[model samples]
Each structure stands twice: as C-alpha cells, then as structure tokens.
Target: MPGRIDARLQELGLTLPVAAKPIANYVPTVRTGNLLVVSGQVPMRDGVIAYTGKLGAGVGMDDAQAAAQLCLVNVLAQAKAALDGDLDRVVRVVRLGGFIACLPEFTAMAMAMNGASDLAVAVFGEAGRHARSTIGVPALPGDAAVEVEAIFEVA
Candidate 1:
C-alpha cells in the first residue's frame, strides 16, 4: 500500500507547512517518469528560514538535528504540494542526500540526518527507508546547520 504520510505526520505531532516557492530559478520539485526529485530543503517555518548556522561551529548537535528535522518537514510539504495535496501517491522514498555545514573536523552529519531518516521510516514503513548520503560541507545557504533533498517513487 502507498504510505499514509499525512496521518503519520499527525501521529508524530507534526503538521506539514505549506510548500515554499523557489527562491531562485529552479522549481521546488521535478517529475520524470515515476520519480519526483525534490530540491534541497532548508529548515523553513512559515515563510522564513527557521535555523541558520554551521554545525559544530555556530550550531550545537541538538539544534542541528532539529534543523535537519525541519528540512524533512519541508520536504514533505513540497511533496504534498507537488501532488496537489495527495500524499498517498508516494510509493517509496527512493534516496536522500544531505549536506551539513560544519567545522573542518565535525563528523556528525549522518547523526543529524537521522532525523529525516527516522521520519521517513515512521511514515512509509520499509519503503521510506532508503539509501542516503550525508556529508559535511563547507557552507550551505543561509549558513544553515543542515539541508536535505529527497527522491521519491510515486504510485
């Protein structure tokens, strides 16, 4: 069965915010074949960037995790928007990629990414669990602690 992403979000005490319009030239999501490629998402709440800074430098690990979690929330919001409010169309989380802006030695990128991974699995069961790569980067937009992008297979 396709996942009940909306119900799962509510179960987690979360309500996805409206998807944000792209700030630049790119679209928020793209569709090709049965796949939907969601663009990189930041920790945005309402219409503003919620968390900003570098991990292990300007932001703590806990806050980084929260920031990553918020990015996932935006991913879901974008997905719903792409599908016109029908989240049931998502079949699986195909892949995930995250960039963590961090100090030279910080190695907690994957740990922060766990917030998104945990949400995926909780929402989609086994299908939401997928390949992921989380790597430390020198900088991200708004100097956010973390940013995440997702690829999903639609039903």
Candidate 2:
C-alpha cells in the first residue's frame, strides 16, 4: 500500500525514480537526528539527463521549470531511500536550494524554481512550504538546466 505522500505523488501523475547514484564521491542523502539532507539532484529521468543547456540561451521558461520539477522528484527519491521507502516519515520540507544554469541576463530563476516549489507544496500540503534559495549558475553537472537540493525533517 502506498503511504500518504506516495499516494499524493501518484495523484499528481508523478513517479519517483530510482534514487540516483552519486556522480562523485558524496552520498545521495544523509540522516542525522530528525533531519535528512539530500544532495543536489539534476533533471534525470530513467537514467538519462532530460534537460540540458543554459536556460536563457536554449531552454525556455516552461522547460526550465519542468527540469526543476524533475530535480525535485529525484530529491524525493533520495529522501525515500534514506527513510526506507516510507515517504510519510517526512515531517517537513525545511528548505530547498535551486541552481539554474542560465545566461547572465536571465532573471527568471525564481520563477523557474517555482516549478519545484509548487510541486512540493502540492505533494506535502502545508508541510511543503519551505525556505528556498534560487541561484543562477553558469553551469551545472551534466550541463543540466536545473538542479535542486533539499533538507527534510523526518520522523
């Protein structure tokens, strides 16, 4: 049976991917006390980088937003793994950090990150409303259009 969070994800037509392996030496997630820190996740779907390139140069606003959402999905996957597949163990989404690969003139980084932030609120309800920071970067790993990282309060 699916837990509440999992059910919400299904209702939203989103399926968590297999937790992605760390591209470098760091682990995907770390749990200490009641907090789970998830590493930055890119827009990967089914083991492939789904969105790449600079946001202002090639990727449009809608596509960048979708990429941000995909990054959140991967973040949840890592959280699920840390909680033994029980997403309900998550009590709160404490914070989210969004990295946007874009041109120097691109100023919609916040709007792009809203894709992930809005989905988080939808999935977790009030618990998903969280502190967030969005940054414009020249590039990200895999040249991904966006990357997202999270801090979760878990039971």
TM-score for each predicted model, relative to the true structure: 0.94, 0.98
Off by over 4 Å in 2: none
lDDT per residue for candidate 1 within 49-103, as digits (tens), equals 7788788777887788888889988998999999988888999999999998888
Error of 2 at 86 (Å): 0.3
Quality of model 2 by C-alpha lDDT: 0.95
| TM-score, cand. 1 vs. native | 0.94
For this target, which candidate reaches the highest TM-score against the unseen true structure?
2
Question: What are the C-alpha RMSDs, in order, of all predicted structures?
Answer: 2.1, 0.6
Tens-digit lDDT track for model 2 on 28-124? 9989999999999999998889999998898999999899999999999999998999999999999999999999999999999999999999999
Highest lDDT: give the candidate number. 2
Model 2: worst 10 consecutive residues (lDDT sum):
14-23
For model 2, give the RMSD to the true fold.
0.6
